[model samples]
Target: MQIPVVLLFLGLLTVPGRSQNAATEQNSATDGANAGEVEEEDPFYKSPVNKLAAAVSNFGYDLYRQQSSRTATANVLLSPFSLATALSGLSLGAGERTEDVISRALFYDLLNKAEVHNTYKDLLTSVTGPEKSMKSASRIILEKRLRVKPGFHSQLEKSYKMRLRALSGNTQLDLQEINNWVRQQTKGRIMRFMKDMPTDVSILLAGAAYFKGTWKTKFDTKKTALQDFHLDEDRTVKVSMMSDPKAILRYGFDSELNCKIAQLPLTEGISAMFFLPTKVTQNMTLIEESLTSEFVHDVDKELKTVHAVLSLPKLKLNYEEALDSTIKETRLQSLFTSPDFTKISAKPIKLSHVQHKAILELSEDGERSTPNPGVNAARLTFPIEYHVDRPFLLVLRDDTTGTLLFIGKILDPRSV
Candidate 1:
């Protein structure tokens, strides 16, 4: 599947309440006179689901950073929420030492560990509800005929809504089943998730997600045309570009990163944020490093509403990767080696492979209503021109829960 290239940086603010309160108290004490005034806690930290979302989304950012660093010259797209879900579910089968490794990796150590799974259940429902356009699924595939403990199987399904499967030992049949399950989960939007089954599969983790989002304000089809998209300083490629003369969007320029950030609303409480560097050949390492749940939350709050002449590519992207190597490079290396999974089964087993596939589409389709007159009335003296005509970063997020649904680094629009 062909997918566009874009990079996204989200600031995830997920400090535990106890520590945050302690710091607040210390600051008040230091400031003496300000001690009488109590700062209101951020409502985001009050919800367990939001806390879990921040933790998993942070993992997603780290995963994206690792993958982008390795594939520096390639377009990278990942819907890592599913991967996080799979790993989080897998943790239920881990013993103490292995559990700690997984927990720290997911940043569960920063949350109420006892409520992680339950809160995750709530998060799954909120983000994957029918009203949302995203579909994500995860599964744990064990070695053929492995005896999975009934308790572990039940717990995984009950919390993560994931099922455990023991391979049938028929490579082709196993391949077909895995792909079929993915297709079913994504409502057939993603197909052929796997071409072949890996040999000696002790434990395989699979994750897949598909998103087809519609803009809150539609772009006129008549205005859409082929346009030049800069790949770098000298090279350019033709890509289908959607345009809007008076686009109302949230905008900000980050001096530190040397990038212009624009946010557009999509249906179902979702938003797509783009980070466009001033220069085509500009390195995106700084922007990637700045992504965290906290930072993204701050950006969301700091951006100003404005009018802009907007143009962006119409994209349909598909990305599939064997993430075993990428994951092994992280703290999760132990899982592929001597980690324990006694909770899952008595027989010794280790993680063999991890696979991920993501499909995302953004087009000109949206509600038929015209731009709000009130927004147009307050347009800047010289409306800002926000054109995504160069290599950029994109982040798709769920507004209600602050979940990082998708993050991509688009070096070239023409790359699939």
Candidate 2:
């Protein structure tokens, strides 16, 4: 969901994820609780998020790939294809975040299988943690329901209860326990994430997952001291930053979106493809067009070493959103096909709600080093910025399917 959702059941239903019924109104007392706040920004806003979105968009495209030029009905199905588009467009953000895509995907794939779907009703609550990192990897969390078996009408929902069960109750195991789980997961590289949880409206059939984690290796404190970072047009600013010159995944520019792409390879070839704008928060058109899976592969092949520096501000942000509108904008409303879907309807499934939330924090680790306090008169072969002065994006993906696990853009880091 591009925003959050509140369910006003005709009568309150004590389902999972809620103790008392969530009211159907806004939290006025919490100012900007839904409005976003700015945070430390990267000169470019497309890195982590846009990369994730591109991967997801490509995956969505694969799902809708013409099942066959042979099917005469394929052309008419274009409308519902918007569902995939809508799913991809959301990477710009929904708030209270996680790079959670795998757990949700595994869960979704299970739901698509009747044996699993029928047996796992509370699967959302059944999932937990991912606290322990899988070798060479990252994650994305999402929870939303989807209609299936057209004539049969089926739906499913899954989230982090499994992670909760997996938790030893040690605060360290909690998803939100670490103040900068996100910063660490992304290598002190990503600084701002929206501070809103994915919406909580229940659905008969939905898919969802959340991800928050710390990087296995953090940047050296001495290297993290203030430095001037690059912005578009050769513009630069002095800000705090971090570095991992040894990181397997290095940063560089990609022709796609004329933005830079970061690759974090997971075990067995999987990787997170982070696409970020060079100088500004991207609009729908630029993002919707350029990105492709082959292009990602090409970029991976062409990766070259470069000085990577960033100065992102510490931020606290909050937001509430309803992605229904964003979905429509992305050309996805047709999946609701109460009508066309009726053609495939052996089962009756209707999507009652969809929502999301995300939260993120970025700051300097206690470690420090003596260096140029402000301007760096010394020129080095490579330069990385410390302060985040502009908007940015990130993503998680699977190398095998080239599936985009998660994607989002950080327009206002303070709000994340």
Highest lDDT: give the candidate number: 1
TM-score versus the correct structure, for each prediction: 0.90, 0.42
lDDT, candidate 2, 1-416, per-residue tens: 01212222321111112111001111221333446742332222133323333333454433323211222221111111123322322221211121023213222221222333232222111121133222111122222232223222212112111111112233333335222444544344334323333333222111222333333234465655555544434555555555544343345543335555555433333354455566653442354343344344444544443334533434332322333443333323442333122322234432334333233233333222222244223233545432345444444444433444444444433343
Measured over all alpha carbons after superposition, the RMSD of each candidate to the real structure, in angstroms, is 6.5, 19.8
State residue 100's C-alpha deviation in candidate 2, in Å. Answer: 27
Can you write out model 1's per-residue Cα lDDT over 1-416, one digit (the tens) per residue? 00112222232112111121222333454566465655554688688888788789888988999999999999999999999999999999999999999998898877789999999999999999766679998889999999888999899989987889899999999899999999898888888898889999998999899999988889999999999999988898999999998788888777667888889989888999999998998999888887877667767876667778899999888899999999999989999999999999999999999989988999998965576555533345566889999999999999988999999999887755
TM-score of 1: 0.90
lDDT (C-alpha) at residue 172 in model 2: 38
